[model samples]
Target chain A: MPFKAINILLLPLLLLGVMVGVWSYIALKIPGFPTPSEVWSELFVVLSDPLYNNGAGDQGIALQLGNSLARVFGGFAIAIAVGVPVGLLIGMSKSAYTAFNPYIQILKPVSPLAWLPLALFVFKEVNTTAIFVIFITSIWPIIINTALGVRSVSEDYLNVARVLQLTPFEKVFQIILPVAVPFIFTGMRLSLGIAWLVIVAAEMLTGGVGIGFWIWDEYNNLNYAHIIIGIILIGVIGYILDTVMGLIADFFDYRKRGRV
Target chain B: MSLKTFLKIDHVDKVFPLGGGKEYVALRDVELEIRENEIVSIIGHSGCGKSTILNLIAGLDTISKGTILLENKHILSPGPERAVVFQNHSLLPWLTVYQNIEMAVKKVLGSTLSASEIRDHVMKYISMVNLDHAKDKYPGEISGGMKQRVGIARALSIQPKVLLMDEPFGALDSLTRANLQDHLMRIQMQTGNTVIIITHDVDEAVLLSDRVIMMTNGPEATIGEILDVNLPRPRKRLELQHNEEYLRCREAIIEFLYSKFAKDDE
Candidate 1:
C-alpha cells in the first residue's frame, strides 16, 4: 500500500487529503486548524496581489522572487568557480590534498546560520549577508565532489596520455576534464541545493524582502494561514530547483565523446 | 644500409632498487638486434623483465645500463615513430571506437589530412581491424577482444615502422586468443611491418614469430637462444601444424627449453 508498482501514489495522497479535511471538520467543532479553504485563499491572495501588503516596502511577490534568485545565483556561481579548480589541484597532488583537506573539513561543519552574525557585523549590507551565507554553505560540496571526481581517473587513461606525448594542458583538457565531468556536475548539483536551502534560512535571520522574511512577518501579524502558504511555496520552489540540477547532472554524466 | 639492424640493444641491463637496501636484478647484459619487417617473439617466465625491455624501447623507462638505438638514433622519450599495443589494450574508456583511432592519427597526420579526410583515414583502419561495425561504441561497451582490436587500430593508424606488442593476447580467452592470433598474422603478412611480440606461450611464439628468442630465468637474466622458424609463408593453420619443418622447429624450442631448465624427464 505504501508503494504501488503502478505509481498509484495519488490514491494514498487523496486519502490523506480527505483525512485532513475530516479532521479539520472535527477541529472546527473545537478550535484552530485553519480550514483547508483558509490556507488556499490566503495563498491565492498573496500570489495575485499587485501590492506587497506585508510591508516588504512596495516590492511585489514577483520582484522579491527575482531579487532572491539574483542573490542566490551570484553566491552559488562564486562557490562553484572558486571551489572546482581548487578541488582539482588538490585531487591531482597528494601534498595539496593533504594540506587542504583538513582545512576544508574544519570549515565544512560550520553551518551557514553560524556565519550569520559575523556576516551582519562585517558585511553591513542585507544582500551581502545573505550572499556570504550562501557562498559558505555551498562551497564544500563542490570542492569535495570535484576532488573525488579528479581522483577517480583511471591509470589506463593516464598511460595512454603519457604514450601519446600529450602536453600537460592537452592532457588535462582532453582526458582529465571529460572523465572528471560527472563528478564535477554531481558537486555542482549538491552545491546548488545547499545554496537554495541556506538562502531561505539566511533570509529569516536577516530581515529582508525574500520569501523567508515574508513568512516570518506573516506569523508576527497573526496570519498563520499565509505563513503555511509561504512554507508550501518555499518547499515547491526548492524541489523544482533541485530537479533541474539533477537532470543536468544526469545528462553530462551519461553523455559520450563530448568536447573537453 | 642493410636491414640487419633497425634496433640495437647493446648490453642492456635493468636493476630495480627495492626500498630498504634490497636490490632485484631484472635484466643483465641483454643484447638484441631487430631487423626490418622481421617478427621477433620473446618467450620467458614471469619476472624475467620481458616487459621492462619493451618499455625501455618505448622510452617509457630509463635503462640502468646499456643503450637502445632505434633507426640508429638514441631514444629520449615516447614518440609517434614506434607505436605500442599494450596487453590490456589501454583504450581511453570515454572515446568511441572511431575517436580512439583518430587520436594518434590526428596528431601525426594532421598536416597531411583535412578534417573530413582524417575521419575517413580513421574509419579505414577501424575497418582494417574489422571494427567498422562498432564504430561509435565506447571501449567499456565492447568485449576484451574488441578493445585489443582498438589498440591495434590505434597503433596501426599512426603507421609506425615497428609494432611492439607485449603479451597482448595473454589476457584474452582461448577462443578469442586464437582468433586474434590469426588476425595479427594476417595483418603482419599483409603489411610486412617489423614487430616484436613478448609472450610466454610456446605455441603462440611458434605460430607468430619469424624467430623465437627464448629467455633464461632471472637473477641476472639473458637471452638463452634464438631459433629461426623456416615454416612457409601465407601459413595454413591445419597444414603448418602438421608440417615437418614446423614440428621440427617447435620440438627444437621445447627440447632446448627443457634441457636448459628442468625438462630432465624429456
Candidate 2:
C-alpha cells in the first residue's frame, strides 16, 4: 500500500491508543477512578438487562436515557415551532427586528442553569422544569440564526419575487423559506447540540430519571464504574444526535447540489 | 414601424446616497421612447449607468426625478407585466430549470389556467429556449449557457408586456454568448415582445437591436447617440459577418465607445 493510505489507516488506531493510555494513567493516579477494564465490565453488565425496573426512582439505564431523550425532543419541537416563525418575522420586518432585538439580546446570554431555579419555583415539577430549561437553552440559537438566515437571503432571489408580483405569503413560502433552509438547519444543528448539553445538566439538578441523574446516583453510591459508563453513554448519545441532525441537514441542503 | 410609444422614460435622474449627506449622480436627463415590438439595446462603458436606465424602466429602482410611463401609466414598482433576465442568470439553485419557469408561469397565469395547462405553458417556454432535455436539472448541475436559457424561459413564461435583459450573455464565453444571442433573436421574432437589453458588446448591440442607445461616460451618464440598425429580420450570425450594413452598425458603436467616450485609463 502507498504510505499515505497506510498513514490514514494507522492514525485512528494511534489516537485510540493514546486516549486509552491517558485514561489508564488517570485511573491509576486518582485511586477511586474506574479503570478501562472495570468500566467495560460494568457496561456489559448494564447492557445485559438495560430495561429492568426495580421500582419508581430505581430503574434501568434504558429508562433514564429514554426520559432524557423525551424531554430533549419535546423541548426542541416546541422551540422550533415558536422560534422559526418569530425569526422569520424578525428577519422580514426591519421595525420588528429593531423593536424585539434588545429583549432577545438581554435574554439570550442567561445560562439554562440560571433558569432552572425560576422554572422549578414556578412549575414545581421536575419534568416540566427540565423541559423548560432545554426549551430556553435551545431557543436563542434557532431564533438568532433563522433571523440572520432570512435577512441574508440573496437580493437576486427577492428581486425575482418582486418582479413576479408574488404575494407576501408566497414570498415567504416560495423564496424566503427555501433559500433560508440551509441556514435554518445550521441553527437547528446548533440548537440540538445545546439541547442535549442542557438536558443532562438540568436533569442532574431536578433529581429525575435521566442520564444526568443516573450519573449523580452512581456518584452518590460511589460506584465509579457506573459513573464512567454514564459519561460514555452521554457522549455516544450526543454524537448520535448530532450525526442524525447532520444527515437531515444534508438532505435539505440546496447549496451542496453540484458539489455533492 | 408603428409610431405609438409603448414605454416612455422622460427626464429621469438617479442619485444614490453615499452616506454622510453626500450623493452620487448616476444618470441624468435620460429620455427615451420605446415602441411596441421594438428591440432597443443600451450600450456604454462601465459605470455609464446603462443598467440604471434599465432598472428604472423595470421599476426595480426609484428615479430621483421624472417619470417612467408604460402604456401611458406610471411605472412605480416591479410587476408581472415587466420580467427581467438578470445578468448572472438568477435561477433558484434549489429549483430545477422546469420549476424555475413553472414558478413564474404559475404566479402570473395560475388563476386562469389549470394545472396541466400551466405545465404545458411552462414546457412551451422551456422548449423555446431549447432547454427541454435539461428541464429537470437544477441550476447547479447545468452549464452557464443553460442557466441563462432557464432565466430567459422564466422571464418569457410570464408573458410580460416588455422583457428586460441586463447583460444577459455578459458572463458566458464568446461561443455560448453567440449561441444565446442567436436564440434570443429567434425568440424575439416569434413573440414580438418589446425588449430593452443592456450590453457592453458592440456586435451584440448591432445584430440584435433595432436601435442602439449609446450612453456617454458617467459621473452623470446620458444617451450620447442612437444608431438605427436597418438590417432585415431573421438575421443569421454567419451571414451578418459578411453583411455591409451589420459591419457599418457595429463600427459606429465601436467608434462611439472608443473615440467619443473612451476612459482616460483605456
TM-score of each: 0.88, 0.95
Off by over 4 Å in 1: A1-7, A10-37, A50-62, A255-260, B218-221, B252-266
Least well predicted 10-residue stretch by lDDT in candidate 1 chain B? B257-266
Q: TM-score of the second chain in each model?
A: 0.94, 0.98
Candidate 2, superposed: residue stretches over 4 Å from native: A1-18, A257-260
**By lDDT, who's the top model here?**
2
What DockQ does each listed candidate score?
Answer: 0.32, 0.70
lDDT of 1: 0.82
The candidate maximizing TM-score is: 2
Tens digit of lDDT per residue, candidate 2, span A1-260?
A: 55798788799999989999999999999988988888888899999888998876788999999999999998888899989998999999999999989999999988989999999999999999988888897788899988998988899999999999889999999999987788889999999998998888888889968889988888899998998898889899999999999989888888775541
Fnat for each model: 0.41, 0.73
Tens-digit lDDT string for candidate 1 (A72-155): 888888988898889889988999999998899999998888998998999898999888788888789888988888888887
